[model samples]
Target: MHAQHDIVIVGGGLVGASLAIALENSGLDVAMVEAAPPGALPPVFDERNLSLAEASCHALQALKIWPLLQTASPIRRIHASRVGDFGRVSLDASEVGREAFGHVVIARDFGEALEKRLGDVASLTRYRPARFIDTQGLADGRREVRVADAEGEHRITTRLLVGADGMKSAVRSSLGIDATRHDYGQTLFVSRVRPQRPPDGTAWERLGPHGPTAFLPRFDRHYGVVHGVPSEEADAVAALDEAAWLARLQDAFGWRAGRFVASGERSRYPAVRVVAERLTAPRAVLLGNAAQSIHPIGAQGFNLGLRDALTLVEEITAHGLDDAAMLESYAARRSEDRARTLAFSDGMARASSNEGLAMRGLRSLGMAALANVPGLRAQVVAGGMGYRGDVPAMCRENAQ
Candidate 1:
């Protein structure tokens, strides 16, 4: 029942799919196992808008996935501010030389684009909604996976095993890796709606005592809003009908751009941070949310995962996918990146989401400093774009 391949990735989410394509045409046989299918996928991006850095754009373009994501909207500018009962600090794109701080992509469109590209990849084998039977890695560094399909037991063995399964990753558990979990007790209410005025290619966030209200530009006239609040308070806030909820959001958010009213359906999800104790061991490695799921306050959860995926692809390509040295290098290379990003994101959520005058002052100071310091601003952009350090092969210019 065992089939042989060069790599076996568990989970076909965004990170895994992108990694598979990155490894394609490199003479490596990649078999992807997923617990779910892409059928009945969500229509439109709904309320999820991700800020993509220029480096991410490069990686996607190199992977040839960007061509399929034509519908994505560019964030020509980012307008950030801390809204206390007193003062505010704003950061405009003009602070940086780039026309926009980054681009904001709708997840639905992003997923659909990736799925379409996946269809054309001849090297990929997808097992949708497949039930895992068992997995064992031999002392020789070879790994085998067993799963139950309609026909029953089926197996595949590969040189490397990957866990891209997500927050509660089964692959992570199977590898006996424990994760450090943090429950913020906050729910994120998200949706796309028509606001009173155009965002003018600028992304805006108002930081109040309750939490930060971020508005990311989407389409011609629509915008995506992410409001973080306590779990108990979520039901009351999110439970309101669109009109009622919109009114509430407007009042809490106040008016910086102008006015915001009317919205589409609303969706809320609890916020949490999950970081695995280890990134790799022998033939096993974690990718995407399987490795770390940070707070969404900075819209970094999935964005950070994409960077990890791209880095893995680059390393594996350079030093052979099955090479133990390369695997260890991948783990070491990602450690600092993961640690720094997690700390920054987790800290932001903690600092900005809490009430108190001291926190408000600090938040405002940070924003103001970030606005005035050109070098610091560039560093932030580089960090966001996935090009901060030794450029991975895929992240480099014209990397296949």
Candidate 2:
């Protein structure tokens, strides 16, 4: 015999663990199974900072974590434009009637905070660094989670199973849902670099021959550099030392920011678009990257994953955790959003990164037009705000 829980959520990363917290005291016993060790949780924010949109701020606030995060710097303005052959167009925060579109938080701090919050949740139990040995459905609509941890093999049974494992979710494999994976053959190099001066309240990006290089302001005189380059060239650049790396950045990004200085070690990641064929099954649901993961071109991956977690929480709460309708509703709502964001993000990344002259001209023109069109701007803004239309009580309230 094994202890049973109402829901067994796999993966305790940002979205997954946050999902567990959101459901706290929701009259359900939630168990989170993570693949990372308990005491080995290292600082994760050293490498990258995440930009949280206005809607994301509001939603996270509802989870009782956003207020504490306000101490981190908020981006009051976003200076966006097309850097290719076409002329440039920009948008200011004031024009949209807001302080800033959102804010940024170091990745390590964000993860640590979420993990700490989970520990405080009275009803949530954590099984850190647990490996799944077997998971099969029972005849009574109950699912069993066979996990191996320090305690050895143990079973976790629940009426519903959640797969929030991430882009390479293992739960998805056990469920046998086909995944659609696309390799863009590009890599994102992320690190913190100092600019000529503290950025003047905005970020800069140069879309060029190799890839798009961006300078995101952190604070003081430092800016976070996110360079999207061909996978083939990523390693060679990442291996450079401080002075040499700074030179490479200058040549690739130009002197628009005055001067570039090395402040953080460079890290790289292969970019891809991963989608699960189905979001829901009989008594299971997938959230976050487990459902879908897309290129980071527009900073859409995390934003989209947050929506998936929030929406799933809403569906389960409204339709009963064990009801098939809950899973279906989550799938339907998310599929629409998942498809729209993925298409927009992947299509744009591909179009913007193309080396061909014809496509470049088209992308440049499209960028200029979108900037000039008021209606188009509003639509893009709303989408960026994570506007999903009639969101759940928790999400809707927080997105205020």
What C-alpha RMSD separates each model from the true structure?
2.5, 2.1
lDDT, candidates in the order shown: 0.75, 0.75
Candidate 1 TM-score, true structure as reference: 0.92
lDDT of 1: 0.75
Model 2 lDDT per residue over 1-400, tens place: 3878888898877778778988886889998887888865523335676777677777788887875563356566555544556756465667888777666677776776776677779998888878766578764778888888887898888888889888888889888889999988888888888776777657566766445677776754678778877888777877777898888788877777788755677788788888899887777878888888888766777878888888877777789875667787777777767877888888877776677879877877877877788998887776766664544455566333
Give candidate 2 misplaced runs (Cα > 4 Å).
42-46, 388-390, 398-400
Q: List the residue pairs that clash in candidate 1.
A: 76-100
Per-residue C-alpha lDDT of model 1 across residues 88-118, encoded as one tens digit per residue:
4455555555566567888888888888888
Q: Residue 280: error of model 1 in Å?
A: 0.6
- What count of clashes does model 1 give? 1
Model 1: residues with Cα > 4 Å off, grouped in runs: 38-47, 85-89, 396-400
